[model samples]
Target: MSQTGTIAKKDALAAHPPAPPWAELDASCQLPVLYFLLSGLAWLLVGTLLQFEAGIRLLCPDWCAVCPAMTYGRLVPAAENALVYGFASQMGLGIGLWLLVRLGRTPLVASGLIAAGNVLWNLALTVGILAILLGDGTGHAGLEMPAYSQWMLLAAYMFVGIWGVQTWAHHTSGPYYASQWFLLGAMFWFPWLLTTAQLVVVTFPGRGVLPAITGAWFAGGIQHLWLTPLALAAIYYFIPVITGRPLRNYHLAVVAFWSLALFGGWSGPARLIGGPVPAWIVSAGIVATVLLLIPVTIVALNTGPVLGSRLGQVCENQVLRFLAVAVFCFVLVSLGNALNALRFRAAVTHLSLNEWARGFAYFHGFVALTFLGAAYHVVPRLMRRDWPAPRLVSVHFWFTIVGLALVVIPAAVDGLRQGNELNDAAVPAVKIFDQLRSVFGWRVLGLALMSAGNLAFLTNFGWLLIRCWTPGIRSAVALFIDQSGKSVTAR
Candidate 1:
């Protein structure tokens, strides 16, 4: 994460009055977000390609399990790392740096430290990604980084987090900026959640049942408090940018944030529903999961009118087109999660392909759509370049949407079929092979479409990258000295 701004302009403004100077961020943040979006699209392509998935499951005389590196076990985690770290986390860090400067209306506190932290963060993710492929993961999704790397990462985040919090304190009074709230909230949330989870889940020895509880706590907290907010912050910032309107109910934004904060921790055990975890623990999670509907409904209602009643207006802007799609996906995923929490529906989907379908929908609908929207709005602004290729943009969006549908909807249906066959218990174990066969072709088709979509996404992004850095398209890069505080120049 790095900051870019017009200091000469910021100095001129700050020289004038109480309002702080707001500098636009430099290309550093843009670069990582760009690269990862492309890379994530690449992995998204791979996950859907099913070429490897098929080969892993078959072709060899021996079973794939013997080769852990090539198995779905490794591939799934590795693919997810591509998304969570390669794509989302880096993008989040990059954007968070920008928002810290812009919303704070001041320069970053420790430019060098932020840069160093970013380097370490990327390095940690790199080690973590390879570790996953090598089957050396800590066995946690978000915490896949080995323990040593995580320690370095932990120290690194402290620097960036300090920059964010200091900059936030410097921001002036205004209409409560929802994006700022999310950003500041995230400044507090991520590390706290990480450290808390680390102590209980990793550092402490709570083997067996106790460790399970701690593990659930760690995972759910990360998704809800850390990752969820970054996605929401992006949503809050970009949706308004696209719709060209304030949230329909600004107060509801507060409600949604607090609601998520209050109830987010006690959920997601709906995920491990059939497992051997204690019943009350699972029931508590069920209740919290269901309660999440309140925040979800509020978010949906607030955005719906602005985005919903004026669908044409919303999509008139291509950026909003993606955002509108993400918002709809958010609503769908939230509602689905609520429904999925119910015992009835979960009975048919527990640990099955349907589970994957739901996850895919959430990933595509909420996280991917949000980031795609972010990319569309961000790239042009950062480079000050003419829009790259309208045809490519439209094609990329359509491909992603269609590919998501193919993967999520079909997998969800197949998951139901698979779960139903297995959960019935009356069906002999011998029939499990038949159930697996039914979903095989669908997985293959879905992966192919997904790969096509990713290729389109990467093509458009790569073209923009080439065009932006070209000499002819160059814009004068802006820099300014920090007057009010010690110079924000990297140490």
Candidate 2:
């Protein structure tokens, strides 16, 4: 109780104050991440425009038939290429870089190179999308971009991704985090996947049917090795942050990561089932796809409690809601994929809208939602401001969920119907076409809703950035409601 004893106690407490919950990432890294996100969102808008055109064409094939570039074949591919390469790839890289830097507790090295890489990456995508519209598409489902543009994209990706590698290598002395493992794994896998696909399918021109096999392989790698990991990394980080608890069964997360890495890319061969390729290839893909359930189950078990504990808070937190939906969708997609890889289902789903539905579930449903959630969390920290429009954010979230549901549900049903009709010799081709007209009409409605949601997001973000530039009036014009429903400002 003496003054000297009290001073000693105070000193002890000061010496080891608990660390802040979040990382103190360097300020300079914000620009590169922001640039990447902005570019990605811009492309998302462009892709949305293309989606409207493609969707309308589905409803009326001859609506724009006079223009070669507006043909369904070209427009659909163009939309896909824009969404995958432009929006998905860029946003994935941005979120990955941000997580890597934060978790590694290091400043981003060579950030200027990353900025340049981002610009070049966007440029390459632009050229590639233009090429597709001009009928220079490679005709590969995932690799529709021309060879020249792909090479440029690869080069640009290296410039940006190397910094992530360096950050991981220089991570602070401690046990590696689960998020870091996934981010680093994605950065490392992408280049190999891209290069392998390019050489086998485009640069070297594989033998008959080989190109198809290679394309399918590359597409699977992109989903499993690249996009899935990125999404997982975000989910892993966001869940703990939102719930104010560490991830339960932390050791299982490591197993999940390794399982995904080991078994993920091999599942690509599932697409080759019933193809010209050897029977062993198809068998390998089916086995790999089925085995994927291991990791999926592990992830579900690990995150389920964390999400369950916070169910009441999910509605209040935008980031938590998005992440919750994303994780659920991820599990569903994985299960669906495994089941569809079975011989019976694959035979029915092959060359049908069901395949497109599955792709949408992965890219739009899982990956995009996770990335948006991360952006919602990260942007405020980067800009030193809160999101200016909560209402708009809510609108975006609901619209996206509804739109995706519309697309996935209807397309899947139509695919099943078409597949059964194809298997039935009694069904006339004209009747089948007529049936699909209604399916495409539903897809067009979904696309319109999605486009509206994306535009709302874009406008909100644009205003946020503009407010950042004019700090003098930010307090007056850039208002955001706090959790208690009280207005606050960046100041």
Candidate 3:
């Protein structure tokens, strides 16, 4: 070897040893993130199917294959299950593992159980989804998964959730960061929701309207307090780290977390406003939904200024680019939700396309897009590989953003149109069909692009995985890796 080459090697040895191989033992880093992304993808697909079927059922009369099981009515629940159970729950587990590994400053503690939980969670979701596909789906929306399945799911998540909470309890870092609140709270919130939802929706047979109300509460609870907090924690950790900014309003962030959790499980049945429920239950829902504004406002306000100066800087980094868009969408969806909570808005939108759009927007933008953005940061680090292309990342962002727009905007317009038509005594139900066709078409278009984007994301994921997993390939690649670069996927 040349003298200079020998000198370079000595300098390298003197500089620092390679990062530990914990990331490999703990591919659990990707689990929670993947769960959220895939679940979001499942929701996107289900949401698309819902929009398409609604339009086709209205326009095409002979579409009898559009039976209860296959129709938008059934597909909506299937999609929700796919997202909540299949994707989001898995993602949460991954997040917990990743966080535990990092905060513990070691390889994951109890990661094997966590890994087992991840597999079981996906398996339960697969079986449950197939059950839905086979038409065994319970007539309920979020509660379609059978009681046994729910219990199975509860067990699966419990395995990981315990470790996530313990990670925070054991965190040696100075003060628990904002991400800890999100990650740890999510760990606690979800099992409560899953157990609660199962009892109300399935276990307690013959409970009249109470089951429906309880189920709704459970669904809303998980959506708001559990998965969302997990996603938001990821957003807080990544945005500041990537942008090199501190969290704005640290005190407000903590207060909002508590208030939001308190108010979360109360808004769902409000979506069932006109149902034959007690006046008090509906009133409570209405009040809770409105009060959500406080937390939403606080969060949005906090993120707004923290991300303000960095908005320009956000683009300089690929990871923040996806986050910045999702963050903005988060603000929009929260405001839309606030409006929907208004009894007046709910009256017009409760069962309308706008409501569906709003639902998808919140679930997709907040959960799916945010997690996708995070994967861009977390995955590459774990894999110890450079990103394939910055342009591909940008494409992924637009695909998600534009797709979300098509889904939400048109549905909102169609929903308002349908509601206005319903409210008018003179208008026939037939005219509402005409309004739905054009808007539903938009929803389908959005999902198609979103799905394609996900495929692109999957390709990137495969590359990252291979680099981290295949020792032979990694040894040959001379991939640029620094202290920040760590891809631990290999088991």
Best by TM-score: 2
Model 1 agreement with the true structure over 204-273: per-residue lDDT tens digits:
6467766567667666666677667777787777665555566788788888888888778788566667
Model 1 TM-score (2 dp): 0.83
Ranking by TM-score: 2, 3, 1
Instruction: List where candidate 2 sits over 4 angstroms from the true fold.
Output: 1-26, 472-491
Q: Over 4 Å off in model 3, which ranges? A: 1-69, 103-106, 470-491
Error at 179, model 2, angstroms = 1.1
Backbone clashes under 3 angstroms, per model: 5, 0, 14
State the weakest 10-residue window (summed lDDT) of model 1. 473-482
lDDT of 3: 0.68
1 or 3, which is superior by lDDT? 3
**Ten consecutive residues with minimal summed lDDT in candidate 2?**
14-23
Question: Please, what is the whole-model Cα lDDT of each candidate in the order they appear?
Answer: 0.66, 0.83, 0.68
Candidate scoring better on TM-score of 1 and 3: 3
lDDT of 3 by residue, 1-491 (tens): 25335423432343224533444534545554444444544544454454455445544646777466566555656767776666565655565556556544445556566667766776777777667767777776578877767788788877777866665576654577677777777888788877766766787744678777887787778778887787878876776666556778768888778777877768766766878889788878877777877777777776778678886777666677777777777778778877787777778878887777777877777777777777776655554455666567777778878887887887887788898788887998887766677775777677777767766676666665565467755543543444345554323
lDDT of 2 by residue, 426-445 (tens): 99978986888777787888
Candidate 3, residue 479: lDDT: 39
